[model samples]
Target: MIALQIIARLLDYPDEALWAHRDDLLSALADSQALDEENAAKLSAFIKPFCAAELLDRQAEYCSLFDRGRATSLLLFEHVHGESRDRGQAMVDLLDQYRAAGLVLDSKELPDYLPLYLEYLASLPLEEARSGLVDIAPILALLAARIAQRDSHYAVLFELLLAISGVALNSADVAEKLQQESRDDTPQALDAVWEEEQIKFLSEQGCASAEETAHSQRFAGAVAPQYINLDAHFESGTAGESRP
Candidate 1:
């Protein structure tokens, strides 16, 4: 719902109000006449993933918004790592509070930070860390540094992320059939069980069912999103109204 609210605000708010304060814009959107439960739920479900990414990306966009040196430093760190909280928080603090701390390093010194970044990566959940492996060379490079720096945990984590991301992207035939094991007999050995669970949930929910709505006319393009929107029904929506 938050994503939907943001999209709605972006759509209806005045241009001057667009990039002002996110909190203020969110509040104004909640208060606006355009917002409603159904549309809001749809919007939120669509934008949730991108919103999370955007919140972090914005810090990288504006230097003076935080300590410029630290902000840029954190981005490079994040490109090769992950952490408990969104890395964007560190970027925000660096650019905003330490913008001119006189700590800019030479481009060559960038490699020196790989160990620190790998330590941060190893501290994260494997699935979380793999999300940063979009550019695997830097990730592998950081993993090598981590191994030499007495932080080999990240090397393992980096490999797991790569294996999982690869399985998700390339091994769809095996991924779709969870009944069949990939390299091991156990279900845990399967790389895509997590993704399969989602597909299973959709199948169970009749998302692909051709059954018509018993009352209102069933529309096209209503199945899969409706399944996703089920999660978006929080404390406020048609589904939430049933909660006592």
Candidate 2:
């Protein structure tokens, strides 16, 4: 449970507050009983360098990984809903669940934000948290595989979550999936997406338009400053910027 909270903090955008709490976070990570020996080693390798790096470097890395495209997006419902109208109602239902669990989101983060969900899970009973992780294990696995492909340390967080949820990632399956996957976050792909949208507006409504707009990111709001850390619950400070 504590590890869930720790993962939530580390998974959020790295900011000054996170840097200030680096020692504490690492200490707490070491204290967690949930992590096995291999997981402990993996986290140490990930966390130490992450904390040792320059603050700006960390933030820039975060933006590059998450902000460019939707493939490795942290917004859980994006994977599930994919711009369908049901996504809206799903957010409503999730927010209601948050309130029912005696938690409130005063920030702009919509429900299903992964870190926020992990924090909520950390607040729950052991079995309850495990069940929550189990429900979304597939999503976590998707993210883990993608991050692992990038050889980024961030993959360890999702791997830990999967292990806690009693799920094992299949490396061969992940390899095949990655082989078939296009790099959506690349510069050319991003330009093409915008160009396609422009053409859709200039053209009539038809199959071309539908296919072009299929990957539209209509709900992603402006990237703003928000604290997704223990700060507001501790003190006030900026955390990281994740385009939810």
Candidate 3:
């Protein structure tokens, strides 16, 4: 759980405060039994570059990598639903689940933001957290592959996430999915993606619809049935709440 929390923190935009505690955080992670030596080393390796860099430089890199494009966006639904109505509905559903569990988001972040999602998972019991991780494994795999293609150190974080969930990454499948869904984030491409008319393939062939349905079904099956009692977590004040 602490490892998850640390990963969540690392994924967030770097800042002076975070930099101040960098060593302490790495030490805790290195000593955590939840992570084996290899994973701990991978995490350390991922953090080391950013840690050695100036905070401002790291912040700029974060913005460039995650905020400048949809390809490596940290928002989960961006990959699955794009700018479609289904994405809106998925956000609402996820927010409802968070509220039901008494987990409130004070920030303006959407429910599908990966760091926020990871924080939520860190709050759950280990089994529930692992199940939650497995539910989002596809998205994680896609992001990991995309980051790895760019040779970014952040790929390790996603790899560790998949490892934690016991999910194997299918590199070929991830590559195909990325090729189909990922678009350049240039102004022209953004306009095309946000155009009034839905793309013919996504709308007519129901690619988005089918994928959304599958993701929804998988998420619902993972959380709703087994964790319905999480609602009671609200009343009992036991469910943990996190903020970005």
Candidate 4:
């Protein structure tokens, strides 16, 4: 009953009175010895997706905060007294709470951005997906800026991350298990080929290291240097002198 109340409260969201009541709800659950591990796990899974979806809905309401996509939900908070304002904040608070508890944010689907970012994410290989998690901070930074500017990017990014969360979590589990098993499981021939190709493509495109690749471009090398050393002096002319 206590855990159920937490779920209910989380769904309720940003209600000042309700937010104030969450601790009591959580404490009630924590104090209750009747709650079983199976029930607790079920409760955790249920809240996980609900919080994720809730964030996605909020991001949809603030589509302008995003780089792509138009706002689909008309029922958005005007930052005035309304359900939208409360609902949005409630989701954010819920996510923060979960993170505080050590749950990871989703890294795949951008709910508002949806199917499109999903497709882009799907195109990348397992390694890319793993690395993408690290690069997510920059994307989040962009979304944060949008949110600051009253744009809807956070909603989009949140949704995307939620979608990616399941995949990331599953991947992590598999990786961990494989490591424990000493990778006794063998990959299919085609899977091996595909994985190899993905690594090569990402490496060549400079996407493997997002920070480095982002700065370098694959140019045609058509334009030459504007100025050349006429003297072609191979030695360092000025060792300790400063030139203005």
Candidate 5:
């Protein structure tokens, strides 16, 4: 559905490519008949000012909201599987599913990046896409509540996604959870997180002292990136094949 495609692009980084096509994106949402009157109006209200703002401002806002903490991470799996071996395997499994659906990714994006996942869903039948959203409705709902707590315009997008999913989710439950949760994106919280993470890494890696941790850091080599290379399959001479 065009609404899915539009939202897929909308969730992506606010680069010039998306900015340049803002008018077309709005036009498609209206012409697609995929959204009802209220959703369309809410989305339009968000997109109008979002697109009208200066590019630098938009980029900064995006980074502030999503890049600062794991709370608003756009990686779908990050919310589900944080620093676990199962997450790695799940990503590969998802990549396989994408290939089976003729959704070979052309970029370096992870298989579970929410925007890319939405793009994959956009290529499916409307009901199937809705089902896909429903599969992750709880995540979307928590995201909606969390972003709403931040008083961000992006909450509308999550709310729209949940609305589209048509799931029987409880917004009140999510809000209650949010009420009891402390903010993780604050500078103090981030620093504490890094310190705790270092301690955890040292313990997990058998570093018995600060000296061993320091030595390990001094000798640390290039760390492998955490990504399932979606481009690997195309290396078999099908790189130029059109995506679904």
Candidate 6:
């Protein structure tokens, strides 16, 4: 699960501290016997360019890809509900889930942020973490495809996440999800997407709701914060160290 923790950090907003420890993070992934050989290689390949790039360039790209557009937004519910009231409710529910597991969000991050979710997963027992990862596989797949369409290397992170989940990647389903939304990253396109009205929840329709049941079952057990090494490293300062 340290590998998950490392990947989560890599996916977070770039900073000098993260760049300083880039080698350490890569070393952890490369040395991890837990990661499949292919994924380990893919991960290294994915990160190597970022490590070699100018820090500001890397930060700019991260901001462009993740910060700008809903198509590649890292907030989970944005893909699910856009800017609707349901997203607000889902955020509250997800925050409650985190609190139930004794995690307090001291930072300004919303509960559905993917890196925060990964950090939460890293805190869980391996089986529970894997189960939670599997539960979010669809969202991961959707994001992976979106990034890949832009030819961004960050897609590899999502690929590694989906691989770790041990769920079969459904290309057709991912493609379908992609097709349902506009891929243009323009402000107008984003406004158009957000303009769509919110759909009612499954419970509101009085339908049999497996998703509701799964949500309840997913966070049933609470584990204390045990991934101290990485957590401490993250909290020590900004994300990366300046290059000599």
Per-residue lDDT value at 145 in model 4: 31
In the range 1-244, model 3's lDDT, one tens digit per residue, is 8889989999988988999999888777865666788888888887777798999888987887788657788998886777889989899999987887789899788899999999898888887788788667667767787777766788889889977876544333455444434334456554544442344445566666666555444433221110011122222331242211
* Candidate 6 residue runs with Cα over 4 Å from true position: 30-33, 170-173, 176-181, 187-244
lDDT of each: 0.33, 0.74, 0.71, 0.35, 0.76, 0.70
Pick the lDDT winner: 5
- Screening candidate 2 with a backbone cut-off below 3 angstroms (N, C-alpha, C), the clashing residue pairs are 13-240
lDDT of 6: 0.70
Better of 3 and 6 by lDDT: 3
Clashing pairs in 1: 4-43, 4-44, 66-95, 66-96, 67-94, 67-95, 67-96, 67-99
How would the candidate models be sorted by lDDT, starting from the highest? 5, 2, 3, 6, 4, 1
Error of 1 at 146 (Å): 18
Once fitted onto the true fold, the runs of candidate 5 whose alpha carbons sit more than 4 angstroms away are 200-244
How large is the C-alpha RMSD of every model relative to the true structure?
23.8, 10.9, 11.6, 23.7, 10.3, 14.9
Better of 4 and 6 by lDDT: 6
Ranking by TM-score: 5, 2, 6, 3, 4, 1
Q: Considering summed lDDT, which 10 consecutive residues are worst modelled in model 4?
A: 226-235
Lowest-scoring 10 consecutive residues by lDDT in candidate 1?
Answer: 222-231
Per-residue alpha-carbon lDDT of candidate 6 for residues 134-165, written as tens digits (9 for 90 to 100): 66666677777778878888887888897777
Candidate 1 backbone clash number: 8
> TM-score for every candidate vs. truth?
0.17, 0.80, 0.72, 0.20, 0.82, 0.72
Best by TM-score: 5
For all candidates, what are the clash counts?
8, 1, 0, 17, 0, 9
